[model samples]
Target chain A: MSRASWQAFREGAYHTLPLILGAIPFGIIFGTLGPASGLSVEATLLMSLLVFAGSAQFIALGLVATGTPVGLIIAVTFVVNLRHLLYSITLMPSVCHLPLNWRLTMAFWLTDETFAVAVSRMAPEHRTQFHWYYLGSALAMYGNWQLCTLLGVTAGQWIPGIENWGLDVAMAVTFIGIVVPQIKTRPKLLCAISACCLSLLWHDWPHHTGLIAAAIAAVVLALTAETMGQKKETSLKTGSKTT
Target chain B: MTEFILIVGMLAATYFVRLLPFALADRMRLPAILENALQYVPIAVLSAIIAPAVCLPEGYFWIDWKNPYLMAGLVSVIAAAIGRNLVITIFAGMATALSIKFLIV
Candidate 1:
């Protein structure tokens, strides 16, 4: 890679350093639970490497523990990860300048945490080299996931019930940090509030469909709020002009 | 064999969902309304994701006097809202939750 690309990559990785804390317990929990659920270490690692979706992986682990059919497990995971589609959509415009191969690799690596970091760092001056930064964050997250999962699979045996130690609560809190700064508008706040309430209400929904429902509700609500605000502005202007 | 199939299928489906629209982003002209709504996607999905993690840490819904998640999460959210600091929010949240869990369980 060029020196510029290399620098961008390092910057990306460095910025992602703090977010890695949130992913650590999550990856370790998945690692520990995978083996405990009767999955072989190899299969667990393969799933973490290839699938790389924590929510879906955890859901799969639960289903596997219950002896749910493989087909059903995949189906459930598909539904659970449909939110990634929204993620992809949100990231598209920012990533559209890259080559096809780079885009493909990025799409594969773009998780919630990486997306948060990458999007925030995409200032106008950095647009040309941002792909390098994206790669940096993506690879850092990938490496962390792999190493943490390995630790969980191997050393996790010595630490009994470590998955339940509430360490993963840090991830939820980190998520709040990611959301809090972006909520400058009333509609955005309401979007978060409504999504939070709906997700709780739909927590028990089958196959993680409730998450999608809540996300869709927030998007729709935000759209309505923005459009209505626009219309009201226009109507007030016309009314004053007529008066 | 079943696990293999599960992994492969999920890999294919998940990757497809991620790769397709991204590839199509340049070629497509999304409607303005859809574009506007996309702005809310990340925070909405994130907020939604957070709800279950705190409210149903054990994969079941429970929010009451006994659960530390709700209380701890509220603490973390307040910290995030006030401090806007990732490290502080995570550490404070985890510390609060762990302390409560330690005290209770």
Candidate 2:
């Protein structure tokens, strides 16, 4: 590869290294849990390949293991992943100039980690290279995930103290790392608090439907708060002008 | 046969959900209300996952003060809020939880 391409790859790898580290334990947990939940080796690997989502896949496995209806499992997965819609929207302008093939390829790898890193680095002027950087980050993450899962599946049975590793805490820590930085406004804070409360209250709902309810509640609360804030701003401006 | 059918149906449904937004996003101009709603989707979904995991570790409404996950999560939050590196936050939280779990649980 040319020096520029190699540099791009190195930069992308450096940017995404933290995400890969965080994802390792997550991938191991999923790999171990998949087989323990009655999924065959093929099925477990296929899930990592197709679904490619850590939390959603775990929820789906639980539902499937519990013999929840297939329809419900699919629906819940869709709801849980609805945030990807927002990611795509935010990324659309940056990626619109790419060819359809490249766009589609990049879309397949747009996980939460890639989205966080890519969005933070995206510049309005250098929109074109955003896809290249995105692809590089995605490739690194995807490669690491596959390797980690392979190790987890092969040695998972004999890994005596794997469960004691506290890898599960990584997910929560990663989310806190991402979310706390973005909670700079009152509306965002309200939305987060409201969603957490609603989720806890509705935790007993079947088929993981409580998550959907929480998401809807947060969206409604945030939108209402934003609308009210805008109206108050307008009223203040009008009153000041009249005075 | 049933399992195969279910898997196929799920794959199709998932693809459809993913494709629907991309297909319609260009053709249909989303209204202001809908735009506003989309803004909270991430926080909402994240809270849905995190809150339950922390608040209900025993798979019920039982709250335990000695819960390592909860304590570690709180630490992680504080660390993140202070703008610590992501790796450091995760390591601190995970190590704390593992030590607590081993010592206590």
Cα RMSD (Å) between model 1 and the true structure? Answer: 1.8
Best by DockQ: 1
Off by over 4 Å in 1: A122-124, A237-243
Clashing pairs in 1: none
lDDT of 2 by residue, B14-95 (tens): 5454444444444556665665565566676677677777777667764665777788878878887786678878777777
* Candidate 2 lDDT, A1-243, residue by residue in tens: 656656666777788888788788878877777777777777777767766666677787788788888787778777666666667765665665666666667666767788777776657765646666777898988888887777777787688668556677777777667776777788888888898899899988865678678867887888889889999999999999999
As for candidate 2, its clashing pairs are: none
User: Could you give the CAPRI-style class of model 1?
Assistant: medium
Give me candidate 1's TM-score against the actual structure.
0.94
**Interface RMSD of the candidates, in order:** 1.3, 2.9
- Looking at candidate 2 chain A, the ten consecutive residues that score lowest on lDDT are A120-129
True contacts kept of each: 0.80, 0.45
Q: Estimate each model's TM-score.
A: 0.94, 0.84
Alpha carbon deviation, residue A161, candidate 2 (Å): 5.5
